[model samples]
Target: MADNENFNSRRHVMRVAAGVGGAALAAGLGVLNAHAADSDGGRARRHGVRTYVLVHGTHSAGAFWTAIGRELALRGHRVVAVDQPLHGTERFVPAAYQTQDLRALATEPSPVAALTLDDFERRVTGVVRRAARLGGPVVLVGHSMGGVSLSRVGNAVPELLAHICYMAAFCPSRSMPSLNACAASPEGQHAITPLDQLVGDPEKLGVLRLNWRTSDRRDRAVFKEMICAGYSDVAFLRVLEGMQTDESMTAYDGRAVGRADTWGRIPRTYLRFGKDRTVATELQDRMIAEADALTPDNRFTVHSVPDAGHLGPEDPARVTEMLHGLRV
Candidate 1:
């Protein structure tokens, strides 16, 4: 995090997203101080103060949580929105992407195509360990595909995470062994995905790449609907600028089940995005139900954001109020 060169490079890539939504998430993670080295990072909650470690979803970066991170910070909570692999600071922008060369973009090989769930787990684990040292209870929050990382990290260091919040994210367990399985469930049938705008072949390219910068108006409209519906055109476009084009299919399809004795033991919460077209509200409920059934005693205390879309034009105050309501 002390690497200023990488930080500058990340800023260069984010010029298009103008706002780049949550890239400031990395800004807050600027450096780790003495508290990081001396603390064990796995102790249980000791007070009312809370440290939030935000994890972003797939084909996206931690910048998506910019406003929320700031809001949490302003409310006196420590915020560390860690940049996952192939995102934020690690983002790789293909040359063809800038040229908008369709053929080249489709066939061009990506450096992140080979990354797996293990890569994501390792990256987040290190960050969470450091975050636990900063203060009170560590409330780890994940959005969209980020839910998988929450589960894996929680299982690995359940003692460190005081609470895990899945904000309309995949929480695979029991019969649902992976995120892919959860996506294929009957409840996920209505998801408005980007399959039509996808580039290349997942099987051949080893990644799921989208043409997020598409010039086609129809494609852009669909992207808006799948992402931040009801938000202004300008808001949607700003989010598009910060968006990435590729995600690791290997990681997307990897196992993400949380063990009962580990992840299940931690207090868990779920915030359902009622207007989520991407994940579908039905699927969100299903994941909560499934996980609750797996651990009846540790059932998720669910909440709802009825007006917000998937990657929202966030009502930070509303979300923050809801977060503060968590019993954990």
Candidate 2:
């Protein structure tokens, strides 16, 4: 009966409509955090301070979390933004690409192309294990495709994590696995034309590479609208500057299914990017709903930033407040 009551309560929370505006969100967050603090007394005693492990998405490295990591550190939290292997180290620019002369561009060779989802999971797990050795609470945070790695780590090592936070990221469900999540969806059909901007054929190159420095004004506009519409032009450029041209296609092929007994045991939060175009609002809701259904007893504590795009965390403060509010 108690389990039934908890499941019903979670269903109600998940069904509540989002897009309530910033002021309301702030108030809701305060209440949610207060409840967490009250209920997690033992957790607070066991782990006095929290360490955050920030994971980046595709085409980017740990540098993507520079602003957020700085903000977290200032708030008296230990933070580690992981640079996924081969992201900043490999270079393979095709001469035919429009941005061939851009010195910042790099692509993966065959060995780097061999990287899989397991490789990323291992990388994140290593960080979490290290943070645990210091005897403090650990929060694993992931953005965009980084959520895939985060979920795998959560499944593999839930005992080490105090919380797992997904920032407008892909949280796969039983019905829609990782590979399927990357496929076109009704909500994301018009979100972005990343394929239209592809510089090389993945089949031929053995990897996916993007020309981030494309000079086309239209391409830039589309890129911004889809991924970083909330960012200033200068800020968007900085993000592009930090992006890698190469990514292992195999990385996207595997599934990161969160298990009911393992991954579902950990506390989790989902921060909806209300204004996101890349992973459209509808799709985010769908993912949240699906995951909640998969693990009804461990439903996400959801929050929203009403005006945020996919790259909203570039501001850091938006996420800092949420992180600060989390008892874990």
- Could you tell me how far off, in angstroms, the CA of residue 100 lies in candidate 1 after the best superposition? 0.6
| Deviation (Å) of 238 in candidate 2 | 1.3
Candidate 2: C-alpha RMSD to true structure equals 12.5
Ten residues in sequence with the least summed lDDT for candidate 1 = 17-26
In terms of lDDT, which candidate is strongest?
1
Residue lDDT tens for model 2, 164-197: 9988887777866773344345554434545445
**TM-score top scorer:** 1
Q: Candidate 1 lDDT, tens digit per residue, 19-78? A: 111111112232212223225433323435677888888777777777777777776666
TM-score of each: 0.86, 0.80
